[model samples]
Target: MTTSASPSPVLSPEHLARAYSYSAYRQLITTLMAEGKTTGTTQSEALTAYAQLNIQRMERLDKQVQVQPELLAAVQGLQQRYVWLVLTEGWCGDAAQIVPVLEKIAQASQGRITTHYLLRDENLDLMDRYLTNGGRSIPKLIVLRADTLHEVAQWGPRPAAAQELFQAMKAAGATHEEFAEKLHGWYAKDKTHHTQQELLRLINEMS
Candidate 1:
């Protein structure tokens, strides 16, 4: 007799219910910053400061970042609906840089796509499933079928070139500040082109 393969793990409705909308996530960070706090269990002045900086970064990107025409066309053409559940934290520099762009794409989809945000520290079980290099990474996008919530595709942490630059910096033993500076610099110069291109590829594969 033939046997069927086990189905892939799916995100439960309860978790999805608890997840934040992009606007809510941004407001949460802003409100927390006013209170000298940040998301996650561990609280620190440093993390709070990072959250404050991230608020500004996200705000700027929300206004400045533009979704490419081709990517917009592809997303708009998708016949299937998707839910982009993102793992992130307010204090994460990479998340601050990238989440706004994801929001823009979702907006352009005009109901074909919906995006949700869940703090990495609070969603260890989900985060554990999508670990990057065996470590929990923020701004990881888990694309799911809107009907069943079964994950269809995933992208994360950073784009290919950014990831490569990150590994190189790590290999060279660059400090957090050093690597962060170079990474954000890369993002600024790249103008979300790489991220959009990668997402476009993922969308094409899905279609």
Candidate 2:
């Protein structure tokens, strides 16, 4: 007799409850900044400084990032609800650059999409499952069907072009400061275009 395979596990309600909503996540960062701290188990002055800069990045993106017209239209047309569970840390520069844009897309979805932010260090099991090149990367978006909580799609860390640049920099053995400056410079110039295009394609494919 033939047997069907078991369904994959879903995030438990208790775990979901522990995840912060976008606004709550922002508030948490704000509070941490006031205390000269940041998300994650290990904290240091450098991390705290990074967190402060990230706060500025996020705030700017929150006010400046706009969903492309095509992307906005696609999100409005989504037939099924989705949950965007994002793994992030306040001190992560890339997360600060991307998460606000995600919030914008979710907001433009007209209640079709809900987003939750979970600290990566606190959710190692989940992060481990979605590692990028065996590294636990922040701002990893796991798109899940709302009804079944089954993962439908995932995107992360950075857009294709940005990822390519990152890989190149790492392979060349660029220092953290050097690569970071270049990466954020690229982000500043690209202004989330590649990110939106990629998400738009993912949404179209899933739809």
Best of the candidates, lDDT: 2
Writing each residue's lDDT as its tens digit, candidate 1 over 50-150 gives: 88888989999999988999999999999999888899999999999999999999999989999889988888988898788899977898888888777
> Which digits, one per residue and each the tens of the lDDT, describe model 2 over residues 10-92?
47776697799999999999999898899999999999999999999999999999899999999999999988889999999
lDDT of each: 0.87, 0.89
State the local distance difference test value for candidate 2: 0.89
Candidate 2 has a TM-score of: 0.95
Error of 2 at 119 (Å): 0.5
lDDT of 1 at 10: 58
**Poorest lDDT segment (10 consecutive residues) of candidate 1:** 1-10
